[model samples]
Target: MQKIKSIFKTTGTKNGTYSVGLTVIVIAIVVVANLIFGQIPEKYKNIDVSSTKIYDITDTSKELLKNLDQKVTFTVLAEKAGADDRIKTFLSKYSSLSKNIKVEWIDPVLHPSALSEYDTSANTIVVACDDTGKSTTVSFSDIIVMDTSSYYYTGNATESEFDGEGQLTSAVNYVVSDSNKNIYRTTGHGEATLSSSVSELMTKNNYKVNELNLVMDTSIPEECDLLLMYAPSKDLTEDEKTAVEDYLAKGGKVMILLGETSSADLPNIASVMKEYGMETEDGYIADPSRCYQGNYYYIFPELSVSGDMAKGITSQMVLLTNAHGMNLVDPARDTITTSPFMTTSENAYAVTEEAQKQGAYTLGAVAEETISGDSAGKTDADTSENDGESDDAEQEEQKTGRLTVISAGSLIDSQITDTFTQLENTTLFMNAVSSNFDGVQNISIEAKSLGTEYNTVQHAGLFSLLVIFGIPLLILISGFTVWYRRRKA
Candidate 1:
């Protein structure tokens, strides 16, 4: 009896030792695993579970971050307790995307000297770059855009959008990029000014829009990347016309937005367009088959997908109000190439003072002229060179001048563009002006909604069946397999 009791004690002691060893091994594994995973960035580990993806960055932002080489920092000015949760969450996710991006939160009250150089409020965020030593501020109001237009009547303000992503992305782009295209809007011709939305869009895309009166300035500026003539009521003077002609000859770009005026009245503008093989028609275009509602004058023109201005546009529909039509002067000009950016159907008709005429017409078009540099300065003696020398000379560099014509000045109007939100009127105009520009990375990202989002499921019956029966069946099968193995063991 004594020997048997001793053996039982030894067995209990060995079992206790084994259990402690197993527990130690398990704890060590968990600790090591946690340490390893903590080194990994949160972007790779944490998944955004929000339905509206408010915490997630867009694919455009991702692509920009992927190719980013320069170091960019975002300094948020707020105390830890007073910081906005939306801004903190977004910046955390944003910084995890790229190693070059660093985000720092500093309390304004504690460190007032940190923001001494910046002219911004306590809640504003500043995006800066070390390499360029450039910095730009994004205000709290800029991040949370509000629609107070209707507040006067309603006595309440509506949240337009949470524009944190758009504002931060644009701010970062501005600080790092060195290129800024100057867009000169021609003045002194009683032209309509650009709407606030249009002007803001140009600024966001890194295009510096400035006013230039050809009548007063004598010539277009040397830094002018694009010349804009937005619905000039009065015609340009002869000197102004000559200045425009000279600008175009030197590989310049021009965008003309036509308003309701007779070709007879604006003969100078008509002549300038005719030089590019594009003639402006007199009257408003009406398309009964392709119009908004029953209003034939509010036309929905079809896009010319092949045109450079319409290259990446997914939708073919755009609104043009009170627009005239354009006619190609010469379809097969030797030196000039023409592409219609937008056109009307065969059933379209034009309403003039005299009568209405039925015909298919171009609503907008782009004309490009390639001027050969080799033949410009050569005399008769230079033309007498041997065939080999002439061939080599012909291969010299050439310059191209481009003109884009849109027959509707109302395309840029706030009422029309803002009302027809589904249409691509604003997008079409931006594409036209920015076709020849390079390194244009500005894209409009939809603002995240601050409202509640409900889960929407399609084919409810199928989803219910999968959840109810399929899942149970899978679990039963897995349990039975596990039980059979245990029993066998």
Candidate 2:
């Protein structure tokens, strides 16, 4: 008993007791830290430090999710073991963003009937809306984009971009919307057909695209919400132009893509543009400062933030290959409001066979005009009557027709394609179309390139020697120095 008392007294010294307490406190801190971190939301926990932010969702997605009226279930058809880490992290962000979004993982091996009702394969994601009983399936291949352009024909092909966010957000929007918008592409004027990438993007965004020939139909179809004319080699006939004018008079939206023309006369189309105070020039634009590979013809246009055409486009530069120049005839037209959404550099020049004109030119522009006289009549009544009802009526009767003109159609042409470089051009085109046809949201997430890397050490032998022997030797020296100091003290 005496020996035991003595032992307790020795162990209960102030320094010993403090050390014991500190150790216990450290263990408690670790336990609490683990608990706290584990409880945090996955979206906040997983920091996306990737160069392209492949896992992070865009602000467009957040805005769409904030207004979600229905519950969306994301069912991943794969075993957790086989699922990719990046994809899993990306999907978790959706559930954390909105309470209406729910994510569930199902192993195909355990329960085959889990996804039996839906036509889904392994590694597929089904975004379903419970309210509408509609669902959209996103294949795994769609998420991982590859460069299929002819530019890669002679070189090694690589994965160009990650479109997981765009695909999943579009799926959510599609399943939740009550109806899809109809887009009509003009035909029979030697117009270029829509590229496969653009077509896939339209389909993913829940747009019903159909071909419309103004010559055969004699009028724009009633189901056409937006009309698209891309790279027409020939000019439109008088009757076709009249049909388009009539369509625009009824609050229609049109997108025209014109390539650089060398003596190609599109008089009827020019007439339509003149009505809206937009004039297309005859030569291609060349810029030294803002071009690809020192090729002056492949110009990069500046994005105009003030215009609705580039409202949601976050890309810094938009490429326009061999583009013509356009000018607003009247910047301050009353009935027609024009905004040059894309412009060339001040030093850029318009190149033609005869001569070169140097100046900043408009490459893309958007025009909005009130075509109906009902608003004008209401305004007249408001001036005469001077009443609050007339003022309110005039405000409610205002409606504007929209038109977007892009100088270069090759920027979006996938057939003459290089997707690795022209991703922003595609996004800009999509944004313009979506903005004009109501508030349909289409998020454009650029793909990340998987390029080859070479890592080399300048002094490989020195590095190996230090790592193999120097660190351990230094540690031993540090311990000995401490012990020696204590002994001397």
> Which 10 consecutive positions of candidate 2 have the poorest summed lDDT?
444-453
For candidate 1, what is the lDDT? 0.80
Candidate 2 lDDT over residue span 1-489, tens digit each = 999767767746757878999999999999999999999988889888765667777787888888887999999898987787777778887778899998988888898887676767888888899899999888777787666773568575456767787788888888888878899998887888787777777876788889998878877877888999988878888888888877776678899998555425888888788788788777888999899889998877887754445546665677778888877796334778888878999988888899899888887888888754353334665555544446566666656677888888986877434455534777777887787765565654444444443678997999999999999999999999999999999
User: Candidate 1 lDDT, tens digit per residue, 1-489?
Assistant: 999768757978779878999999999999999999999877776677866666777666777788888999888887867777777777777888889999888888998987785767788888999998899888877777778985997998877667777777777778888877899999888899898778877766667888998887867888999999999889988988888887777678899999877667999989988888888777889999999899999988888754435543667778888898888887344787888878999999988989898998998888888865544345667746634565456556466788888888988898987766556777778878778665564444435665565788988999999999999999999999999999999
Model 2 off-target regions past 4 Å?
Answer: 6-24, 145-161, 288-294, 330-334, 373-399, 414-423, 450-489
Query: lDDT of all the models against the reference?
Result: 0.80, 0.78
RMSD of 2: 6.9
Clashing pairs in 1: none
Clash totals for all candidate models: 0, 3
For each candidate, give its TM-score against the true structure.
0.76, 0.78
Every model: Cα RMSD to truth: 8.0, 6.9
